[model samples]
Target: MKKILLVCSAGMSTSMLVKKMQETAVKEGKDYEIEALALSEAESKIDDVNVILLGPQVRFQKPQVEKVAGGRVPVDVIDMQQYGMMDGESVLKHAESLME
Candidate 1:
């Protein structure tokens, strides 16, 4: 199974995205673990994840998250338009590409 981590300012809104990602993963029969957390908690969550996705509001923190990720995982910022529109398929595709 693959692990994907999402980081945001407070983690609340991003949890919704986590749900969508989960649903997409289930529909595709993909084996994966996805979780969302506040930026403050990101350091502890980085170790085992394969990818790190940042919420638009937290885009400024990408460098920090990447530093902690230390090349072990690919880190990216989720598309704001997709995120605001709640486009699960697009987000899922983005996540899948990271694994590839």
Candidate 2:
């Protein structure tokens, strides 16, 4: 299964988003291993994921994460509107596009 990592300040809110994204993926018959983590833990976990999505609150950390990713994994921020709405499908679509 492909892996998607979502990171935020403390990983709490992103956990809810992860559950929603997983539900959407299953409904679409796609099997993906999605997870949420605190930015502090993201660096240790970055190498294992295909893409990294930063929560709007933590979007400023993008360059740091990208540095750790070393061009191997795509890094982006979840759209502020979509993230505020917890729109999993849209975020998943964005992640899918990045993975492709």
Candidate 3:
């Protein structure tokens, strides 16, 4: 299963997104291990993830996350509009594209 990590200021907001993504993944017959974590927890979890998606609220931390990830995993920010709308399919697609 592909591992996707969603990071935000406190990990709380992304939890809802995680659920939506999982629902979409199931509906689309995609296999994935998705989870959310606070920015503070990213370093410890980076090694185990295939892709890192930053919540828009934490987009400023992208460079720091990338640095910590050391180019080992792809890091990108979720589109603001999609994120705000909680469009799981689009976010999942974004993750899928990054995995490519």
| Better lDDT candidate (1, 2) | 2
lDDT of 2 by residue, 20-44 (tens): 9999999999999999999998999
Tens digits of per-residue lDDT for model 1 on 7-42?
899999999999998999899998989899999998
- Misplaced by over 4 Å in model 1 are none
lDDT of 1: 0.90
User: lDDT for each of the candidates?
Assistant: 0.90, 0.95, 0.95
lDDT by residue (tens digit), candidate 3, 3-69: 9999999999999999999999999999999999999988899999999999999999999999999
lDDT of 3: 0.95
TM-score, predicted candidate 2 vs. hidden true structure: 0.98
RMSD of 3: 0.6
Clashing pairs in 2: none
The runs of at least 3 residues in candidate 2 whose Cα sits more than 4 Å from the true structure, single-residue gaps closed, are none
lDDT of 2: 0.95
Q: Which residue pairs in candidate 3 collide?
A: none
Candidate 2 Cα RMSD (Å): 0.5
